[model samples]
Target: MCAHITDSVLYRHLWGTDETHALLDDGPRVQRWLDILAALAAAQAEVGLMPDDAARAIADHADVALLDLDDVAAETRACGHSTLGLIRCLRRVLPEPAREWVYYGATVQDLTDTWTALVLRDVGALVARELADIEQAARTLAQQHRDTVMPGRTHGQPGLPITFGFKAAVWAAELGRHRARLTEGRRRWEVAQLGGALGTMEFWGDAALPLLDAFARRVGLAAPDVPWLTARDGVAEFVNLLALITATLGKIGQEVYALQRPEIGELAEPVTTGQVGSITMPHKRNPELSEHLVTLARLVRSDASVAVEAMVVEHERDGRAWKTEWAIVPEVCLYSHTALRLAHTLLDGLRADPDRMRANVDAHGGYLVSEPVMRALAARIGKHAAHEVIYEASLAGRERGVDLRTALLADSRVTAHLKADDIDRCLDPEAALGAARSFVDRVAGEA
Candidate 1:
């Protein structure tokens, strides 16, 4: 029985995507480990530490389907060692010539960490592709809504006018930075770990360096300068990057969640037939996918925190910290994949309501464009006096629950400097959105 939500049959979709779960599942992970074993055997043969014939057989018969996982689990319980049981089960299935060389000269960390390198290599590529898709979706939103004006809220109050395109461009610009980070951090985190016990390859003698290079080439990873037995920073860094990516997705989700509110009604996530938002409330149209992105982000961040805590490992081969990564690393990768996938979906079908945006902006009764009026009044009267006149009129209008036009018209001070037409021009929210269109164009062009 699976106790974790990521493995639970009912709640797994809420925690991870199908693609992500497949990558992090026990069977696939074990196959990747077998791949590392095969590479290790081949690398040892390249350096003359093991016979080439044995290495070839190990590589040929490294399929996980041949070994009974139930027996492997039983051996793991009886032997009280992590990789030994795996090696014992693996050895039993290999041809007589290759059985002894199946895991030649490699420790548990060597196989697991090398598998981590492959995980990063594959997962990093997947993340970059999906995130680029997210950027493209945001770019489309920015381009489509370049002139769609909306209220810019500050502290939960409408402060000024801004186009919806500008908001989307900000998201695209941030996604671009994440792409840069992933590209730059790839080589640093994709190096293979080949250190034997005590961070030295004592078993392979002088063939150690050559074996390391061969193993890395065989596994399609970079050769590490030194073993990372106690140095868990690479794992920490990978998970941290995942955490940051998920955080950005969380921000996007939060924005959609808030905007999909009945009171706001400016944006909504895509809905499908037979997908109920609530069991009892039939009228509720909830942001299920967007909300789940936020949930997945929180879970990834928690896993990243554990990765950081794992960095404090003591001495060489500290099982306490390194072992934590056996779960934490896979969790971060899985949760991050789910978050990115959901973000792509949420952005793809995002519904932007320009009519509601205009209505929301106008609901403030011209007060939202107060800055434009203040600037216009400033050109005539001294800046301080203009501020005082408009400030007093705005307060009176709010108190009387009337538009700024009526309040300004009733004030002799305002009337002396500005006509009704001039005030109307200044009160237009569309006129107040300065440089918003240009900003969208700039970000979209760069993307």
Candidate 2:
């Protein structure tokens, strides 16, 4: 039986993927633990801490498939030791001389932490690739809709004019920053953990540091300058970064979900012909992909909090903290990967209703152009006075069911210098989208 929610059969689709399944599966995990033992033996031999022939023999045949996993599990339960089962299983497979040398001087943390590093390294590659794909999709959308004007909302209310390109550019920029964060986190997270009992490497004597470096290189990871048995910051930092990435994707997803509303109709996620939205309501086309991204992000954020909590570990090795990570880190990575994958798809097939955007913008009868009008009026009067004048006119217009132009034209304080034509020109949605295109260009250039 699996211990984590990611491995649960019922909820698996929400929090897991094949890639993560492969990375965190029992078979792969045991194989990696065996690989760690093999590398440890080789490193010990390379530094003259163990017999070369013994190390070679252990490395030659440390196959996880050859072992009796049932016996290993029984021994694990009996001994209450994390890797005693692994050691016994490997010993059974190794020659007499090499049997005793397997997992020579390493502790549970050394094995588990090294495996954690391996998982992080692999998951990091997956995340980077997916984020890159997402960024590319967002870039494509931004470029394609460089001037597609829409009403930009604030607090769920239509407030001002903005281009679809500007919205996409924001997503691209956020994704680009996440890519950078992932890149930076890789170095800090991909380092090895070879600290022995008490993290002193005392068991290996003089061969410790070199063996660590050699072992890490053999496993294609960086050797830490010091033992990180209790320094859980790297793991915390890595998961936190993943959380940030998911949060940004979730933000984009939330926007899509909101804009796909029938009342707004500014954006729509791709709807395949045969896809079912609701059995009761056959005509509905829900933003399922976008909404799922948000769900994945929420789960990732929760896992990230768990990861951060693991950072407050006690002493050199805390099973409580490290064990929590065994569940949380992989969960966060899986959730993040899901979010990124769906986010890319959401962006790639995203459909914008330019006509609907214009219609929505026109529905308010020039209220979205309030900023432009206010700015133009500020040139006549001070900004504060102009804001007050516009606010009263806007209120009266809302009460009387007329455009701001009609109300402003009726007010002598507003009509003293401005004519109806000037007000009409200021209320143009296209004209009101100040610097949106420039911002889109800037994002493209920066990205």
Candidate 3:
């Protein structure tokens, strides 16, 4: 009966986690709204804007289990307002005296935006934890494969030699940067939004600032300099950070997908017992998780664009922009959560083939060591001139189906400056890996 794939009974596991789904579900969302109202009431009472007894009563009955959500929905539709139905339903459950002061002067934005801050705090924490785990796994790979030589590629072709550890070190370094971003961004995106209808808090008079601080304290968030009723930069920034994170994950996935090809056969995603890659093809091991990571990144990036668009709303209050976040925020969180989880699983059990990697490098007929050859020749015959000589020899070698050493030996320009022993040294893949092992050590040591 679900409409979206994210909510599908059979496939929801692919899109989100149970913990995040529970956090954003209707029951928990409403409970959070009620909790925000209770915090507001308590803060209002603390500021002497409302009676202590009424605040206590509202707090006691703030449970979502006590309300008839059907009635709440009908009232919402009847009133054509986002929070009125919920307010009315809440009033019905409250004692007579507390009913009048249940919501007070707060608007829907106050409740929803604060709820968003809380959600971001939770999601950001989850992301940070998952990123740490992923970083550690990548670091482990880097250490394990510090000397596992592979062909470094550029423009989809073998360019030079590199260690698999170097590649994993890159992933770890990027993930570490994301972790730092999360830590720094928490202060900006995890603050409360309690501006009333006009964002001026005029309804509460002199007690506004005090109430804001108290409410934020109750919810364990920082109070902002002002209400963000129309300023959505914080939300946009957080979503965009998620976009950056997923994009990195997608990059890693793409690498795995490419290397898992039978022709390359240097890396692979871990396959579980009895896992079927295809129903039609009996001999196939598709890079399913890697492909899904790319798909999730695309979706998260799309959501980030919507978040950016939401930043340009009209003055004071804009339902068009604000309501978009109602959908976009949860979706970005869910998709990002799923991505982090999958990435962790992927890296934890990732399979690397050292022999296959060495074989692939050898398969290139010493072409992968061209960079080292060019560099060594550069020191002798001026860099540009050596480039032309190597370029011509490389083309001839490929046409003649011979190794780089044979090609170089036949080229008078190359043999004139370098002997066979020098050419052999240049063609060594280990010599071609300039500073790769050192970089791996640096990244893994820091990790």
Candidate 4:
């Protein structure tokens, strides 16, 4: 059964995405643990810790479907331990000779953390692909609307003229930073975990380090120089990185949601058939997808906090903190996955209402071009003095319900610099979008 959003089934559509569910679900996770055990067995054999034939047999038969998950769960609760249940289940499938060597000297952190590395490797790839989609989408929009003039708002008020391309470029830049984050952060995260009891390989002796390297190579992860049994900074850092990624996506989502308001009408999400926004309000086209991006970010951030807070663990192995990770890590990965995927789709189909953008700029009556006008007049008057003059005029204009240009025209101080035509030209919103296309070209070309 799918997860529910709320008490009302009508709004349950935004509960979760299929991709997120798959990434965090029980069956896939169990399968991953089995795969890790198989790799460990093969690597152990190479290091002369186990027989080659036994290792091969263990690798050949470590199938999740072959074991009963219900039994695994039951044993897990009955034993009150992490890998014991899974180990016992796998033992049932192995011959007596192989059963002793199935897991060998590995610990729970070794299995679970390595599995986390595997998931991180895959999750990073998925996030990169989706972020690229969003980046390309924003690029296309930036290029398409290179000259589409709109008001650049500050403090939720129209402040200056800027092109739609410039706005998209800013978003693209932020997403570019996210891409850089994932690229650099992956190396630090996708490291193997194979430390025995108390961060020492005492149980396996001389064969421990070699076996760990072989296992990591077999599993496509880098062998860490030291064990991270109690040192969870890497896990916390990785989760925090995901939190930053989700926050960036949330920023994009919030912008779209705010711009999609009917009164603003600057942008709208792509409307799909059979997708109802509201039942009570017939005339509704809510930014549901973008809003959910924000929601997913919040959930991922909460999970990240748990992971970070868990970093202050007791010596060697703290079940209190490590067990928290068992719950939080997957949760963060799941929602962060959803956020990235949804952000890609939403950005790909985003509709930039250039006409409405222009209309809004025009409706603001030259108020948005105050910065350019002020800058132009700064050459005539001192910068601070000119700012004061323009500030007063702007406030008066708003109070009297007159255009900013009109107020400036009546001001003797501003009139001393130039004529009415110069003011009009300076106030043109499209004329003030400085080097937006150049920036778009630079970033897009690099991408």
Winner by TM-score: 3
TM accuracy, model 3? 0.98
Candidates 2 and 4: which is better by TM-score?
2
Q: Assess the local accuracy of residue 196 in candidate 2 as a C-alpha lDDT between 0 and 100.
A: 86
Ranking by lDDT: 3, 1, 2, 4
The candidate scoring highest on lDDT is 3
Error of 1 at 231 (Å): 1.8
What is the C-alpha lDDT profile of model 3 across 191-310, one tens digit per residue?
Answer: 998878798998999999999999999998999998889889999999999999999999999999889999888988988889898899988888989999999999999999999999
Alpha-carbon TM-score of each model against the true structure = 0.96, 0.97, 0.98, 0.94
Candidate 4 lDDT, 14-50, residue by residue in tens: 5445665565568888888888989999998999999
lDDT of 2 at 26: 79
What tens digits encode model 1's per-residue C-alpha lDDT throughout 1-447? 788988998888867777767777878888888888888888888889999999898888889898888888899899999888889988888888888777776788998888887888889988999999999999999999999989888887778999999999999999999999999998888999998887798888999899989999999999989988888888888899999999999999999999889899999899888888789999887789888888888988888989999989788889999899989877888788888988998999999999999999888888888888888989988789889988999999889989888888988998898898999999888789999999999999994
lDDT of 4 at 404: 87
Clashes of each: 0, 0, 0, 0
lDDT of 3: 0.93
Runs off by more than 4 Å, candidate 4: 1-20
Question: What tens digits encode model 2's per-residue C-alpha lDDT throughout 360-429?
Answer: 8888888888888888889999899999999999999899999877888888888887888888899888
Computed on alpha carbons, the lDDT of every model, listed in order, comes to 0.88, 0.86, 0.93, 0.83
lDDT of 4: 0.83
Poorest stretch of ten by lDDT in candidate 4: 4-13
Which residue pairs clash in candidate 4? none
